[model samples]
Target: MSEPLSVSERDGHCSLVLTRPARGNSLSADLVEAMHEALDSAERSGVRLLSIEGDGRNFCTGFDLAGLEATADGELLARFVRIEELLARIWAAPFTTLAVAQGRTFGAGADLFAACSVRLALPDASFSFPGAAFGLVLGTRRLARRIGEDAALSVVTSGAVIDAERAARLGLATGIVQPDELDAVKQRARRDALRLDTHTIAALRQAAGDNPIELDRDLAALVRSAARPGLVQRIIAYRAKAQDKNRTDRAAAPSTFQEGAVR
Candidate 1:
């Protein structure tokens, strides 16, 4: 199998690309492990800027649900806990963290984007936090810190798709940039990241907000949600409902097309 992540460093900037385009760059167990390893390396290297991007089509479609049928509830809960840990690391990173997202950034993928210090979305990108649909509480605090309590509550509860424009307006995304402008955005981010020493950056981040206690609380919340009985069943049911909705939409599309043709 191909590698799940690509990591490269230049100057003071480290770029981590999610390379599993075939799987929508979903966070499988292997991908999550690779991310932790990459982050560890970046931290040791004292990289000033850490940029994350997806290889194709989508930034990430969220957690990998390919083997949901075979996986046990305990395993699923462990996966979510690890994902929450990854998000926490990004949220409190000493170096500046940037996420350039495109296409469908949903669930934990959207949480990953929110964890970054700078979030840039492509014009076609859309975000939805559907973890609530399955009773998962990942990234709630971090997202609220990014936007606001009410806004985060509304989005998570409703599972509404937030377009790039709305994401920027709500402050979930720093900006919307075309593919051509991405390089410039990264360059600017690099400059900002290198402006301060790692120690100062870490200190500033601490002073600005976020603490170990809150991080622990976030992890605890996720664990509590994931530990609920029937997690596997909950996810299975959610996926089934989503699939049914997709089928219904697709079935309606043909009739709408025929109507337009008749007109």
Candidate 2:
């Protein structure tokens, strides 16, 4: 059976799992729609705690770069805006949102975790926010909340992998556990989370209301900035850099040419 985003529930806990393992659970258009729909249903269903995870070893590898290329740039930009909307919806969600991250989490994937109330990382998992690579501007408030301003800027700009221990220490991840023990840790968290009343959950989130909105504005602005000619050129430059990673010899290809890999 084709795996749509998977959802399951028990007690007051509701869980969402990104499925498309063949593509490393990447957030494609379909997955994005599924996420929005899932949020809608979860809210209507009286879920007290919402848990998000990925089906494969990785939490999420990031946007479906291959899919991103096939679609129009305008459409991609619209989706980035929609993500801002989603972040707001997530913050407004009645339930306490929990991100259960394992393996790779980058770009959009990292943003998803940052949107959550609790971020649980597998000890082997890692994250990155390489806006420099794509000429896209990923903001840092979500990241800055976890790490400081300088480290947040460095990681997002440098596009380097931040490992689990460091992520936890930086506050990017609220808790870190060995991969094998992650399921157990998640279970305890979920169980305790379910006991919390909806009012309590709402109150805790209400106290942080402006935080998500500020981050959303920053993310949305960064995305629009990429639409500018200069940033778009940088985006194109990054594409070549990406291609260089795959090539062996120094013989260069056309900078403007699209590769066998479209995304």
Model 2 — which ten-residue stretch has the worst lDDT?
A: 254-263
Query: What value does the lDDT take at residue 111 in candidate 1?
Result: 96
Candidate 1 Cα outliers beyond 4 Å, as residue runs: 254-263
Top lDDT prediction, candidate number: 1
Q: Local distance difference test, per candidate? A: 0.90, 0.74
Report the alpha-carbon TM-score of model 1 versus the true structure: 0.96
lDDT of candidate 2 over 1-263, digit per residue (tens): 68559988887788899997777787777788888988888888888788889887778877676643355667667766666567667756777889988877877788788878789988768887866566676546666766778888888778887899988888888988777887787778777777877777777766865455675577667676656655434545666776676473224555643223312
TM-score, candidate 2, is 0.83
Superposed on all Cα atoms, the candidates' RMSDs to the truth, in angstroms, are 4.4, 5.1
lDDT of 2 at 29: 70
Q: Provide TM-scores for the models.
A: 0.96, 0.83
